[model samples]
Target: MASLKTTLVAATILVAVAGCAKKRPADLPPPPVDNSGPVDQGGATGPTTGAVVPGSDADFRRSVTSNTVRFGLDQYDIDPEARAILDSQSAWLQRYPNVRITIEGHCDERGTREYNLALGDRRANAAKNYLAARGVSPDRMTVISYGKERPEAMGSDDASWAQNRRAVTIVLS
Candidate 1:
């Protein structure tokens, strides 16, 4: 009777341990290859083969001339410099039709939260409108206002304030 009981206990533990074993999943296929060549906003081409994935943030930053545009103090207008940057961004968007983006408007630390939020909205919308006018579909872009909550530069000086007041474009796949 003792021998039979010991055998039964060992069998139960072995079965439990075997049931807890991890199972391996089937292997997945490799990602598709892109044969198209790399092109810049200026119509210039670069090395055809690289590790930069398409519709990725790295690709967007590498392809566009500039992703962030600065604004004047208490202003949200698209100046000549900002316009040029947006032009390049629009071209990049045109190239990647499926990639969506978010334009974030920011403000200096001097303004009230409410005022800064409103100003930020205006800045973001200004950028979105510029891209839309350049033939980018409005549906592919989103606008957001960070106000003074997120600052690019940290300081009370002119340089920090100048850097803080801007609009930034983020690539969203």
Candidate 2:
């Protein structure tokens, strides 16, 4: 009977320890949003026009030349994907003289607020430099860092962090 009690106690302790050892996974990124409208699919209306967007089936050149390209985590470095997208963006900027864009940088919730802010700025500046190097006027680009304040994804996992660490381009009026 004493042996049975010990065994029971041991099993109970094991269960408790196992329960405590379990880990929680971070939230994941959501499905892509359907960003339709005349403007999103390489087509634009009003004011600006005649910009080309590669890989788009729109009937005509987009009116404005604002294209957003996403990037990887912990990296302010511009990757091949980003470069291809920027190349297309540069073509558009070259076609249109008066268009200007703002690069908004964002980071995940893993770092300190100030650190994230600076990191975000670095990311934005990295993108800005790339655009400038591509022959876009330095005066035509602006950079803003949102750090962790604005999230493209709210998950605590790598997937969410990947989504969060991005530089988005918004057209400036």
Candidate 3:
């Protein structure tokens, strides 16, 4: 009888343990996470959000021209071309009040890392200020300096370097 009782107790504990086992939801997928550096949505490789779903980044890029403005060598000034782009961007931002963005500043691979980072920061702020002056709320925009870390064009040549020296606006949902 004692043996049977012990067996029943063990069975009850097993059942309890089995009942308490974690059951993961089958319908929901895990949130997106990038192990490498900052999370980038709808990157140069294209949208990674979903197969058919149109991503916010894609939409923003389409609505707003190139989403990028080139800077002169070692310069953070916004030229007439850059000003025109910013004007259009401001109009788009006004249309989508809820959308927030981050202006990424980049530099050519010529200056020291520290100097490039500082220059990149200045470039980012220049773009942000331009937008703010054009009526886009400063609260909706943020600036980040990639410096020469993430270059659009890879090469030591002037053409590639020119491409690298730019500020790009990315949608942050």
Candidate 4:
């Protein structure tokens, strides 16, 4: 009787351990391998493998020189520098016909919310118009004004204010 009981207990323990083992399904594919080595940029490792995924934000950033444009104080006009940046962006947009984008306008924290909001709208529209004139479809883009609510820079100095007053383009697939 003792021998039979010991044999039963050993079998039960073996079954329990076997039940808890992790097993992958044989039909599932193996995980993708990363063949690209690490790239160093500004003390950070930027891993860029072959071919950016199509219609992706990474592709847009890789193809364009910049995704942002700066504005003068209380102004929304596209300067020469901004125009150059928009030209690159427009070219990238034309390449990816299916990708949609949103242009967000921002302002320095120096004006009332209402005034800043209005100014930001103008800035966003200015960028949109520039892109449209460069052959990108207006329907592919949307604009929003964040005004002083979302400042890129946190300080009140000239440099920070200048940095805060800008328009940023966001890629939305």
Q: TM-score of model 3 relative to the true fold?
A: 0.69
Clashes of each: 0, 3, 0, 0
Q: Which residues of candidate 3, in runs, are more than 4 Å off?
A: 1-55
* Local distance difference test scores for all models: 0.83, 0.71, 0.81, 0.82
Q: Candidate 1 — which residues are off by over 4 angstroms?
A: 1-50
Task: Tell me which of candidates 2 and 4 scores higher on TM-score.
Answer: 4
Q: How far off is residue 159 in model 1, in Å?
A: 0.2
Candidate 4 structure quality by residue, lDDT tens digits, 1-173: 99999999999999999999999867742222121323222223234644456656666666687778999999999999999999999988988888899888889999899999999999999999999999999999999888898877789999999998988887764
Model 2 clash pairs are 44-63, 48-63, 49-63
Q: For model 2, what is the C-alpha lDDT against the true structure?
A: 0.71
**Deviation of model 1 at 114, angstroms:** 0.3
- Give Cα distance to truth, residue 35, candidate 4, Å: 26
Q: What is the lDDT of residue 36 in candidate 3?
A: 30
Model 1 lDDT on a 0 to 1 scale:
0.83
Please give, for residues 73-109, the per-residue lDDT of candidate 3 as tens digits: 9999999999988888888888788889888898999
Model 4 accuracy (lDDT, Cα): 0.82
